[model samples]
Target: MEWKGRRQSDNIEDQRGAGPSMGGSNPFGRGSGGGFRIPMGGARRAGGGMSIGTIIFLVVIYFVLKMMGIDLLQVMGEGGQTSQPGFEQTETASRRSSAQEEETKAFMATVLAETEDTWSGIFKAAGETYEEPKMVLFSGSVKSACGFASAASGPFYCPGDHKLYLDMSFFDELANKFDAAGDFAQAYVVAHEVGHHVQNLTGILPRFNQQRQRMSEVEANQMSVRVELQADCYAGIWGKYTEQKGLLESGDLEEALNAATQIGDDTLQKRMQGYVVPESFNHGTSEQRRRWFKRGFDSGRLDACNTFQGDI
Candidate 1:
């Protein structure tokens, strides 16, 4: 990719060394794996509401426990469980030098700027305004509106805050561990999360979250696959626009496709557990991901990227 000297986005929030502490509480739940998340419903009080005195007493007790070195919220967050499994965690290699980190940050900013331009144009053409999302750059773990997440969760877009949370270390794992290396491959990861933001803006994510409330776990997982594939398709659309501007070089498309293949739920499952369970698949298979991305790249039309209608 010819990204040098290109315009960079100003919406980046660099919190590489200032990630959230482990004791923090995540009331909503852990964020989803890499992609769009279904907003988890908060626990509701049963048997009507508590009295004012009871509420005040509970608040006082909460602070008392905190002063005594106990966090009820943290305990609750830890106890909360979900059937959905997040992305696998891998040991990141030693951190890159300062120079390399800066370059990667610049590259990410430039890629973000490209997506902003592409999506802005597309939205304007459809008589809608595109609101650009902020990208948060953190190191180990970060607290988001969705919840607290580590780099193992990979790069994800949180609809609650309309922001993309990323840890650059994941890119290292993507290359060294997953064998998907290249600047364009890294760009694909960013584009995929940004695609989730686009879904949120289009009401797709909100509708999905609302519907998933009543859906069975298996049914929700199946629907999640479609949502993730659509994001991949959206990423491909950005790639198409980038290519038209003569930014994509030889093998860039393959780099992105390989990255998509490497991170597919099926491929990761097979590699991690030496088997695959189709029922637990939230993201699509390797072939499905690659195909959907190519479908968007070839057509470059919003309607062509619809994975929910008919066959994906």
Candidate 2:
């Protein structure tokens, strides 16, 4: 991934070092493992699929599994409220990013810029305008329209606010714990979240939510798999752009592919629980993830990412 010297996004909101701010009254429930279990309180029934709470909770599970065996999902309040109020919300006096942190920040900014460019061109060709989403860089935890989230919550895109919330420390965890190293792997993560933003922009996410309300739990989980797989494909579409720009090296694609497999629902479940539950899988399996991404990479066409229509 040749990201240095590339343009960084000005949209990045640097909230690192700022302490968590309180937002609501509901507190997070503690899990037996000493981690927070996201309570499904204040969650309302959407039309056919999972509610926003259920969707966010399911996403939180992935972060929980990756967190060195810690559970961090918590229910803050209605509307995805994250943290309770009264905590100090101030930036550290000597706040400064380490050299590696600085480098990673630059890399992320470059990747974001590339995505903005690629998506803008894509939308223009389709007779539409691309609305680039902002990315929030925070440590510990931060608040969003979706609610408060700790670093353990992992990187997520809140359609409510049209921003990608990320904790750069997850990059280290991706390398050290998940064994998915390389800058491309990190880029894939960023791209995947941005892909969700794409879904939001295209109204796919809204439609999915509407359809999900009528689905059974198992059926809804299957739908969620489709959503996640499509994002993987979209990430691959971005990967295609990088490859075309001569930004990708020989092992770069492999790194992203490895990352796809590493974070597969089945892979994470098996590693964390020593077993796999197919029905519980929201994000696709390893082979499914790898294949969908390859599909997008091979075609570089938005139509190629229609995971909901075919036998994914």
Candidate 3:
């Protein structure tokens, strides 16, 4: 993939060294300590305690901040300082990142920009507006609206916050452990997560989440396979757009296909535990993944990527 000097996304939140405890304020207009609180009660109680209305107001504020991706209680526990420490640590970590890691970050940003452009165009053509999702880069562990996650959890999209969380170190694992080397493979990973964001925007993810509440464990796993495979197909749609733009070079398509194959549920299960359990397979088999991706790549149609219509 030739991504150098291309447009990069400004929606990336580099929280690389901020760790799980450092939940920063909202990146989009929710200012830090803006002092716009409702004074429900101006006077304190007889014993120097807060009034009932004051306590209720504080509780409301807490929940509001939580919804905005800011853990106000956590911030108060950390001395009411959210951005300074995390910002300084992230800056130091960025300076410490090797040249290669910085390049990887740039590549991720470029790919994210590509997805934004591609999806925005598709949405606009359909008479809809695409709200681009943010990507959060972290090291070790991070706290998201979905809860706390470690780097070992791999890349994931959180519908609760409409953001994608990624650990750049996973690319090294993808190459060294999974043998899925190459930048296109890395782009596939990023695109796959963005695909989940697409699902969230389209109401597919919300519907699935609601329906899964009444499903059995086995049934939920089966449904999850469809969700994941649809994401793979969506990634292929992005790949098709990229190819049409002449961004893909020789062997790039193969790299993405190999990546889809390598990370398939069957392949990963066999490689990790020497066996495969079909019922527990939530990401489909290697053949299924490769086929769906090819379907999207060949057709380049949204309708071609629907995995929930039949036997997917």
Clashes of 2: 11
Compose the digit string of candidate 1's lDDT tens values, residues 226-272.
99999999999999999999999999999999999999988999899
Clash-forming residue pairs, model 1: none
Q: Which stretches of candidate 2 lie over 4 Å from their true place?
A: 20-97
> How accurate locally, in lDDT, is each candidate?
0.91, 0.89, 0.92
Candidates sorted by lDDT, best first: 3, 1, 2
1 against 2, candidate with superior TM-score:
1
Q: Candidate 1: misplaced stretches above 4 Å?
A: 19-96
Q: In model 3, which residue pairs have backbone atoms overlapping below 3 Å?
A: none
Per-prediction CA RMSD (Å)? 18.3, 20.7, 16.6
The 10-residue segment of model 2 with minimum total lDDT is 85-94
Task: Mark the 10 consecutive residues where model 3 has the least summed lDDT.
Answer: 19-28
lDDT of 2 by residue, 110-156 (tens): 99999999999999999999999999999999899999899998999
For residues 22-123, could you state the per-residue lDDT of candidate 3 as single tens digits? 355575565556643456765667857687888899999889989999997687767645557987999888787777788999999999999999999999
